[model samples]
Target chain A: MSMIKTDKLIYEYAKLDDEGNVIGTNRAIDAVDLEVEPGQFVAILGHNGSGKSTLAKQLNAILTPTEGTVWVAGRNTKEPENIWDVRQSAGMVFQNPDNQIIGTVVEEDVGFGPENLGVPTDEIWTRVEESLKKVGMIEYRHHSPNKLSGGQKQRVAIAGVIAMRPQCIVLDEPTAMLDPNGRKEVLRTVEELRKKEKVTVILITHYMEEVVGADRVIVMDKGSIVMEGSPKRIFSRVEELKKYRLDVPQATLLAYELQKKGVKLPDGILSTEELVEALCQLN
Target chain B: MSIKLENINYVYSEGTAYRKQALKDVSIEIPHGQFVGIIGHTGSGKSTLIQHLNGLIKATDGVYYFNGENVYADGYNMKSLRNQVGLVFQYPEHQLFEIDVLSDVCFGPKNQGLSKEECEKRAREALEAVGFPGKFYSQSPFDLSGGQKRRVAIAGVLAMRPKVLVLDEPTAGLDPAGRDEILDQIAKLHKESGMTVILVSHSMEDIAKYVDRIIVMNQGSKLFDGTPKEVFSHYKELENVGLAAPQVTYIMHALKERGFRVDTSVTTIDEAVEEIAKVL
Candidate 1:
């Protein structure tokens, strides 16, 4: 069974007038179908207002679909009884680490989720230590979150989610507010967590480089899935991605430009090493 | 006309257990009409340094001169200084709170004691400068998209007619095209108005493409200050400080290591492509 499945999901919010009356409806998420198997790493790429975030919201039932259905861990998100089960099955991390972290101390923050889930006191501490260790933040367990760097705070945020022990994790532009090193830290931690815990990973981001390592990539535009394939296959269509207001990784773009200039380079070079290898092979 | 900071030092929570120095003996000079990029890791004092520009945060020990006038002089008007040195904070869209985009932009100039018509006129000009569509002028800022809201926020600052515009991660949450559009408009603004632009950003690629000069900050001190090609030549050292040169720099360096006769100092894609083509 799939860890997450959306069947023609459609989410619409009413366009309100000055007096707060609904004038019409704005389709934020149009009819779309998506499926993610357990332990798979998926990346969703889109511009702001492209409905990628709306689709992520549907995974944990933050916003139930206006039409169609979303299933997490074989449970329907729309069903009120299954809401807890769906949420427990899929953890979410947001863009701003400052907004997501609540507890003062690092370990306390990581234990917040499981504590709310009614986990016993002893197990909460155990889960807290284990999750902190997994995210490489165990040393900062007693430190104040306010003093931590952006990358450290974000890793603590991930540790909080990990303590929930969800079958899947959905990160909505988690690295948007971080610096280059911070972004690298969060991505490495996500990759490491995915391997160790076998949790399904769905990352939504605007950074093209961050998606290069994903097993699959989904391109969203105008509230619909416009393209879907492996990262290399999707990046090969650089012109199409640009049409949707998205970009290929820098290396891929450089290769494409070189190809256009009549240089015999392969399509979809995803990294500097790959591009260097391709260029060195020429002549 | 220029901005100068000499021996600037900023310490947070003085005499307390959490006392820490955010900026240490940083001295730099930025001339008028120069587009400068400041690159640094988070908590490296990038924000604190920009905050000092518009007198938002006063340095504990430093001398600041703005256009030949001492900003820290007794009885100097900080309000006028702020008007001349506009600072746009990160995630600027969150700062937008006016009922409509036009009025939101007008707030800054209006606060400067300008007449209502003058305020609106400046607001309109600023909006147009940012390439914001006229159709969205009357719409609520809350109704606009993230990119559009960010533009309106920038317009609010630009409406004040500042001589030196400072933006802190203006493209933090924007998409690729949106980022390019904003940066290009800023570049155009710099070209046409000749106003100094101090852009603090994390993306080395954007910095290399737009800015004429780059300043690298680490551990609250100026680590490097030079042209894009010069600063990026120290890509290895930059990586040690949790920052990096643009991807093209790495690609060029790797190609050079592979015995290809390529210029490792190439920062932008265009330069890399041209250099690689020349070598091939």
Candidate 2:
């Protein structure tokens, strides 16, 4: 069974007036279909207010679809009885680390998720230790979350999600607020977590560079899936992505520009190594 | 007119065990109407340095002179100084609170004691400079898109008609097109009005493309200050400080490493394309 499956999902919310009257309805997520297999790393890219967050909220039952259906691990998100099972199967991490972290101490924050799930005390400690180690934040387990850097705090946030033992993880712009180094650190941790825990990963981000490593990339525009393919396949059409107000990786842009200048380089050169190799072949 | 800082030191939470030194003996000079980019890792004193420019935060130690006057001196007229130097914080849109976009932009000029008519005229000009449509003047800032909201916030600062504008990651959280739109407007403002532009950003590509000068901050001190070509040449030093040159710089270096005779000093995409075309 697919780890996550959305069948023609449509999410709409009432546009409210100052008097709390529903004046109109804004369709945040239009009819969209998606499927993600277990242990697969998928990336969702879109501009702000493009309904990427709305789609992510659906997977964890944070927001049920207004029409159609969303299923996580064969449990429908709209079913009230299945909400707990759905949430257990998929965990979410948001952009701001400051808002997500609740515990004063690092390890304590990671343990909160499991504790709320009614896990035993000793088991919570074990999961906390394991999750911290997975994200390479074990050394700072006892340290205060307030003192941690943006990257470190984000790592602790990811550890908190992992401690819940979810089958899949959905990160909605987890590194959006971080510096380049912090972003690199968080991406590396997420990659490492996928390798160790074998959890299905769904990352929604605006940074085109981060999407390069994903097994598949899904592009959304106006609440619908406009493109879905491997990173290379998607980034190859630079002009199409640009039309959606998205960017390609730096190397990809250089190669594209070079190609426009009539240099015979291959398409979708995702990294510096590939671009260098293509340029060197010209000689 | 120039802004000068000499031996500036800022200590956070002083007289305590957890006291931290945010800025350490940093000195720099900004000539009038010059565009400068400041790049640094998080907590490397970038914010502290920019805050000093507009007199938002006084240095715990050292002298900061604005246009030959010591701003720290008593009766320095800081209100007028702030009017002269506008500082736009990151995600500036969050500060917008007025009911309508035009009023939001007019808030700064109104606060500066301009007449109602003068405030509206200045706000309209500022909005035009930021490419905000006149049709949206009466619309609530909350009803605008993210990019539009950001531009509206920037217009608020510009409405004050400051000689120097310091933006802290003005393009943060904006889409690629939105980023270009904001930067282009700032560049246009600098070109047409000859206003000083100081952009604090993490994206080296932006710095390389827009700024005439680059200032690198590391560990609470000035690491390097020079033209983009001179500063980015020391890529290894940048990497050591948890920062890096633009991705194209690294790609150029990779080409050189691969025995291709290409200049690694190319920072922007156009320059890199030109150099690579010459080689090909």
> What DockQ score does model 2 reach against the true complex?
0.72
Candidate 1 TM-score over all chains jointly: 0.99
Candidate 1 local lDDT, A174-231, one digit each (tens)? 9988888998999999999889888899999999999998999999999999999999
**Model 1 stretches with alpha carbons more than 4 Å out:** none
Give the Cα lDDT of each candidate. 0.93, 0.93
Residue ranges of candidate 2 with Cα displaced over 4 Å: none
* Clashing pairs in model 1, backbone N/Cα/C closer than 3 A: none
Q: What TM-score does candidate 2 reach?
A: 0.98
TM-score of candidate 2's A chain against the true A chain: 0.99
Query: What DockQ does each prediction reach against the true complex?
Result: 0.85, 0.72
Shift of residue A49 alpha carbon in model 1, Å: 0.4
- Grade the docking of candidate 2: medium
lDDT per residue for candidate 2 within A145-252, as digits (tens), equals 998888999999999998999999999989877877888899999898789779999999878889999999999999999999999999999999888889999999
